[model samples]
Target: MSSYKKLIYFTLLLILLVYSVQILNIARFPSQIDIIKGDSRNLNIFFPFSLEIMEESSDIVKINSTNAERLSVGLKNSYNLESTNNGIAKLKLKFLGIFSIRDIQVNVVNQAYVIPGGETIGVKLNTKGVLVVATSEIQSIDGKIYNPARNAGIKVGDSITMINGIKIKDADHVIQLLNNIKNNKVKIEIERNNASFTTEVLPVKSKQDNSYRLGIWVRDKTAGIGTLTFYEPNTKKFGALGHAITDVDTGTLMKAENGEIMRAKVSSIEQGKKGSPGELRGMFFETDDVLGKIENNTTFGIYGTIYDENKLFKQKQLLPVGFQSEVKLGKAYILANIEGDKVTEYEVEILKLEKQNVPQSKSMVIKITDERLKEKTGGIVQGMSGSPIIQNGKIVGAVTHVFVNDPTKGYGIYIEWMLKEAGIYVNNNSEFAEGK
Candidate 1:
């Protein structure tokens, strides 16, 4: 090829690459805004922040607005932009002591605009804050039976604090460590209500691989929710979210996913602050969903056309695509009709909204606002995924996950996202999230 021609081709390639990268950036923009904005969405089910930091001081990398000015704060420190403030601002730090590793690893660090004193040009700094993590591996057996986990001083319902003195990074790390140390005795730590404890256990050898096994099961992650996806009036059969719930430890989706979807009523919710996220909690299983055929339970939603729809809905209307945009910021509601119960409503607020590149959970935030709701579910507790998020008299999204440290702050997946995964189309009348 001629030199000029080669140069032209290379230049074209460079342009294409730049364009591609720009497109990718655009795709991730909404999620980016979500993290910065925090909990403006009313649902306590979505975690918008990506990065988290564990530090003694609240000094943060301040995030500034494009239109405002900056304050005299130390550079390189984390900060947050006030939605109300036109410029960069830092939140007063609170909470001291050790933070969960999961809370520190979320993706919240990114280039933030810091307008210093009415200057349009702003400096970029990485922000620090708390992130939420979830797990299903908590062990809280009803009766105290002697077992390896217990002998190691591991108590039922005690949250695994750390493994081998190292923080439990994620479900994958926990599994990998357990699988590698087969038959080997290992130390573990746990935390409950701000208190920390430790224990040790020897893994048993598995005939299958001659590797060590801990007869005890542990979990670290999960990401799916379903709303009584279907209900059968007769025989009292009901399905949720049209998908199977999974156990992150085994990397297997529960069959018949026999776990019941309880009514998690929410109580009070903390407002989303600069570093710390909020949560909701309430009681559940005041009713239960009997196990039935496990048809389809994918990332889209849970599915098992139910045997009973009578008790689930006040009146069953062929389900429609729940438009997320119609959801307002405050005084929203939820419809949890799982396990042969009437679709009950709970009060919540859309604290933040980011229709951008959301992670496993969409880029939105919410807080449970109803006291009656809190007393029922421990503030967005488990078995509540797939509860329909309704606002402005429309179905918007389904509850997907909860924040362990702060149950009142949970995560939710946009209904359209779930519908797309389920091969359901968003009709013209349905509102599609902009730039998502």
Candidate 2:
């Protein structure tokens, strides 16, 4: 073969190999897929190979090829799957003549509903136990610098639940327990990374204060302000933050042994800038009238029960919850309280929608388009984390995080996951009947 022809052939072969690898990389579908009954979804087949449905578990799922002829070499294909009935289905895809099979589990559910929330609320989280935020060098009576907590295998982020077989109540209680010990080793039970273990540490008498010290800094509580996402009227359950509230010092999720949500008023707004996220300064004084009790502080958000339904519904009404498929890239509005206790709607543009089969915090990228909101808060800020994102008169998602470089742009979490975290199940069949 001529050298020119040989080079051309080699280049073509390399391109084909690259394409094949790409197809193989994504050959398998996600373990489970969910769709509402009577809804249709498109599945993309990246490989240049024909596909045949080898098996289907239910007749409710109807699969049809959209571009089967395009499955030729160096081409792609797609299929449309429709759900006619609500049930689970198992689909088996076979690569034509390739002997490769991929299985997909499909769940056809009814519709869901949730009450949209945008009220700015105060979050006061008391950890299950005192958390070790930091360790320091203690100057003992002998004039020697000693790190008792460090030497005892206690690290930052560890929760000190008990000391000397006594349950620790708070930071002051921990201090009292350590000071009462007289230069002796004491057993400490701590929870680290979900594992519970025990350790012994010797308390040293501080020369400066003439008190026994453990060379550790601990915290028992954290408080902040954030937007409320949604509330389930049937269960009186509420979700907020759209993300976990981690300890500011330890950077770990605060285990909410007991917490409360209180009414807050935005006192001031600090506009966000590049690399510097702004915040909403608010005062929550009416602590006596507890709005809700926080139960779980998971990655999805904080789940709680609202005590006063009248207070939450006085300003806002229940809105329909939108599924991931219903979310589109277009204009949307967020409910937020930038001033006082009144919840107001602000315009934003849905820049991108990520179709995820699994739950995730950043389900969509949104940008603040409302001139009023942009001028007031400089786009999404710290306290706006759980602002309910409304599209087409339905609550689709919640604002989760803002882009550090662009304050106007931020991430959102789908409302479905927040409802799941709140322990609210969506009955699509009944929701559709109620015109939700």
Candidate 3:
């Protein structure tokens, strides 16, 4: 080939290469970002030949970005974005500081100030209805095996709400309704995945007990211990458990018709080991000393209004919620109560961060680095789920799950999602939010 032809070929290849890098740069950069007012975030673009931060509103978000700053190799271009106001701002990202790539909409939210809670609280959850956990075969009075629930299309993870047009209360209520169901086809209303439906079934009399049975196991209530994550001082709301309180046998995310948060004291510890998760055994009064009434149960955590303000553990320092973008990969501490109503600061290191755009349970991977905590309970145990993760004087996230293979490491959830779910003040302007 001639030298001129070779020059043209290399030029075309260079253009293709530039175009691919620019596209990847655009793809990797997030389309939207949220920042707390008065907090500054350093945005680094790893790709060399991409982006100019063109500020549309300096009052909302001030941009001190360098588009022309030269970096040799393996160094990212630095852009400092400072949030100034409690509103929305649009920052334009351009290619070669001229060609418009896309707009990065910035949500400037007010700092979510909350009291960090590490108090081990007793959670008494009364499910919406009787949760059908399992269907079993029963030896009937006719000397035959039958599963009446399976025959009637009742499956596990179903909520049996009503029987014969009467709203069922609990397992005892179902047993009472079984009397009316004996030898008669009864209409049973069930709720699955938030949709309501009904089925008909005839209860069979058990051979051994001589009692009418549906051959299905169900539970209406569950009680357990969990660490409280945070308490919104202004709203009097609290969030706990970091993740949903699922049924042990069926793994169903429990729907709470009503529940309560009470004071609990850790009695003993079951040390966690590989393939065997440990637990913090605690005791609480069921009928007395109710701290708060549970209003919602979600994948993020359990949330509710606190009736007793004195029950919340008072923290020495203030904690404004750290957004997912602000959470750095480094050392952090979790506020946990391992023994006898005493909240202790345990050192933990953040191993990873998930740049999530939406709400999720696992937001970061963390390891227990505190020797004192490891010696007591062998890392993250069962009742430590909602322990608040504190980093840089902020409530970054909460411990949600434990690694069964390695007891020292576990997953944490972003505190922003929990604050939003609990109806705490996060977005300052609803009108501004809705306009976008």
TM-score of every candidate: 0.38, 0.86, 0.81
Per-residue CA lDDT of model 2 for 120-170, tens digit only, reads 999999888898899999998899999999999999999999999999889
Q: Report the C-alpha lDDT of model 1 over 279-356, residue by residue, as the tens digit.
A: 333333323443333344455455433333332344455333334434556667766532233356778887877653
**lDDT per residue as tens, model 3, 1-436:** 9999999999989867865775665677767777777788777664444444444567787777564467444346677888777777777776555677777777777666888989899999999879999999989988999999999999999999999999888999898888866778888999998899999988999998988889999999999999999888777889999999989999998889999999999999999999987999999999877899999999899999999687554434557788887789999999999989899999999999986766888889999999999999999999999999999998999999999988899999999889879876344444433333
Full ranking by lDDT: 3, 2, 1
- lDDT measured at residue 269 in model 1 versus the true structure, 0 to 100: 38
Give the clashing pairs for model 3. Answer: none
Candidate 2 lDDT at 78 equals 75
Residue 182 displacement in candidate 3 (angstroms): 4.0
Alpha-carbon runs more than 4 Å astray in model 3: 1-32, 41-59, 62-81, 90-105, 139-144, 207-210, 314-317, 425-436
Give me the candidate number with maximum lDDT: 3
Candidate 2 deviant stretches above 4 angstroms = 1-28, 48-56, 68-71, 93-103, 425-436
Each model's lDDT comes to 0.43, 0.83, 0.85
Best by TM-score: 2
* Candidates 1 and 3 compared by TM-score, better number: 3
After superposition, candidate 1 runs with Cα above 4 Å error? 1-23, 26-244, 248-292, 308-314, 317-320, 337-342, 356-360, 426-436
